[model samples]
Target chain A: MYVAAKGGEKAIRNAHALLAKRRRGNKNLPSISLAQIAQQLTLAVDRVMAEGSLYDVELAALAVKQARGDLIEAIFLIRAFRTTLPRFGYAQALDTSEMLVRRRVSATYKDLPGGQLLGPTFDYTHRLLDTSLGVADEAGEVDDEARQADPADAAPVAMPRVTDLLGQEGLIEAAPADEGAEPFDITRAPVSFPVDRSTRLQTLARGDEGYLLALGYSTQRGYARSHPFVGEIRFGDVEVIFEAPELGFELSLGTVQVTECQSVNQFKGSATTPPQFTRGYGLVFGQCERKALSMALVERALRWKELGEEPGAPAQDEEFVLSHCDNVQATGFVEHLKLPHYVDFQAELDLVRRMRAEQAAERPADGIKEAAE
Target chain B: MALMARAEAGELEAVLAGFAPLPAASDLKPPEVGLVMLRGRTGGDGAPFNLGEATVSRAAVRLEGGASGFAYRLGRDVKAARAAAILDALWQDEARRAEVDAALAPVRARLAAEAAQVRAETAATKVDFFTLVRGED
Candidate 1:
């Protein structure tokens, strides 16, 4: 049974007012602009974009600012905003092979085609805080001339994928042929069990980074261990193409930066198939390297049944992972505890009180007898 | 359309403003902001999968002279989307086509320069690994 409880509108309104003031901080300090967050706090923006499942840097930055830097809140804000906009249609599948390579590396190979480019990464940086960053930028500071490259030194336009090299020697399993059929849309339909690879990939792609990281770590700690090597990880921009009904031909819809990881896992030969290296793939919006790698590991671990491997780990259970992966859904259920539950609590209280009264009536003199004893 | 889509936030709008008395075009489809679900292949070459969605604004316009043009671009710049759609309609006419190209030339150049700059910076980081010779060798 449910009952209505009201009369907090004024308090709610004032709380919102207080929140706005708190979000602003000191009045003397200049407020952070959306541009600043979009450019400097780019990774934060990227995270909200990835998990929110909506790619718009400006909006993500806005959400970050509005949420007072609370990433989960920011993601919630982005998701709420997503419901207002209508879906135009699906775009053509992205071709990562045509990416304008910014950073490309392979852990399994020392030397690969097109060579490795480090780009701008914190991988080699010392963890010590740089006091220099605390100070405002000095105007007109120039970049090192020596760091600039000659046009002739540029990498080849298209770097061959690391998997392809292994594939040529029949060491790695070949990719299934492209059927050109439309993939399942998770956003449109409710997720059911026995989902296809497409649906699983979509869920993982939009899943929370921290959750995926923990699950991936579990796999590495010998829970359904699949000896995995990062075949390739690349981050860069790729053009998005959409086919509009009004426009008969496909049209380019600008570009988006994405990080992609391909994990090569060992698969012992099944009774019917030969022994070969299997694969796990991850692709996410913007330069989210860690998240992409984690997604790949978890994705591979989840494929145990398909690969004929014994499955017992938490990550291998698709239902658990998919159901709990979405932070928006997870936070909603967890946070709803804060809302008024007076009726439900009253019912429980009544039940408990009645049971206590009955117990006292049944043994009215037991308390005095126990005390005397 | 590609050049316009790649143009800076206000670049398209500024170019459109230059042609003060714009060629009157009817809205075949008014500018509307929406999402476009982006798809990706499982293994980069195999079965398809949904990656995510991107914000897109699209508009369709028909010029007075009976030419129709449409545009779809990333982000929520409604005015820029409409401006690109108008330019597309104008570009269908042979005489107005050159005018459109001349206006968008700077954007094309800027995009090219930006691409070149990234390519150069990336090139500088390209590693050439060499194995050391063992003393026995």
Candidate 2:
């Protein structure tokens, strides 16, 4: 008895039209430029880029603009764009030690070798939104300082790892990379069960930051706790290097800003290896400190088996965490329910109506409507 | 090969246009262009994070003489993408390399000139920092 509704295409088209109209919002007002989004809404752009698994500011800004400030939608747009691109070759492994340090901090030691630089952080800033920021000129001294690079602002300093001190006494795990091993390309292959550490890390890298943060928070609430110590947290620019086949040598491409965290966790010994502390690492594009730190925590928590610890919680379960980490996939699955389910619902509707009519007939016909029992 | 890094959409198309009597290439895969999310790591040994997305166009073509060419370039320039693919196939055919190179010479020259222009502009603002030795030292 359910009538099939039509005009889905028309509805979608109209909705898109409405969205565009609202996106412009009163044409008299000046439009928001992509450059403005890239510069002003930097955190949003960074998040979109991180989640989208792309790293161009201008394009991210354009995505943000096209998506009308919807971060997830912007990420989707980037993903759609990324789907068609041809693969260039991969680059050599990046070295955090060579990073031109902008912001560096360590929670373990009171003092570090190169010293702690707070840099541009919201840590101490009052959360109160100042009215003055709403105005361009009122924000005080809109200068060229932020636009230009200054060597005098920050020296390229590489601080010694805080774990090195503890490691001297043989108290930390030595996490060595397998040289000359090709990392699993998650993009190229579907997610397999019991994924390798490289794939796990790669998936986690682009995983939703909020979800990871929540998972990390759950760990702090006594869910597979890895009593973490910040060995060093650094934010800075690092040059990209790749082997140029034509040149027959590795050449520097350019530099990109990144945030890295090396979290030293409690020491655990294997049967063969003596008691040594292990480190969870987090590295992300641009200046997303929270994501980086959360990644390290979640990464450390995921290392339960390698360190011989019991996999006790959700975060510890690699399959559960990795599978649910992608927001794009989760969002799509959840949002798909809003689409037409008329035929399926009509079957349920018919069944319910028939049951009701049968019950009515039985009750009216006789008091012989006794329970089956 | 040299143009891969620096060539944008317009320049690539202009260069591709130089091959006026464009050689017919059998479509192995028709050109498909889309944005790709760019990712990077810290210093390079770190967790990968999205830097941003870029438009990338790719095409693969096979020449009549059995040479195959595949091309990949940044941004959404399908014409340029197809041309590059054709040239790539032509390049593989030893007889066509010289002709292709000749056709692309102006494009390279233009790129070099533009690069030089940028260098000139940068040099205009070039500041050389100097060390002043202190008497105490």
- In terms of lDDT, the best-performing candidate is 1
lDDT of 1 by residue, B1-137 (tens): 88988887689888888776876888987789999999888888888899999999988888786588788889999878888888888788787889989999999999887888888888898877677888985
TM-score of 2: 0.71
Give the CAPRI rating of model 2: incorrect
lDDT of 2 by residue, B1-137 (tens): 54533455566567666766665678886787654434544213434433334455567788775688766554456667777777777778888789778877776787656444433332232233345688985
- Model 2 DockQ reads 0.09
DockQ top scorer: 1
State the C-alpha RMSD over the true interface residues for candidate 1, after superposing those residues.
1.2
Q: Each candidate's lDDT (Cα)?
A: 0.89, 0.70
lDDT per residue as tens, model 1, A48-150? 9999899999999999999999999999999999999999898998999999888998888878878888888888878887676678655225484677689
- The lowest-lDDT stretch of 10 consecutive residues in candidate 1 chain A is A136-145
DockQ for all models, in order?
0.76, 0.09
Q: What is the lDDT of residue A331 in candidate 2?
A: 86
Provide candidate 1's TM-score on chain A: 0.95
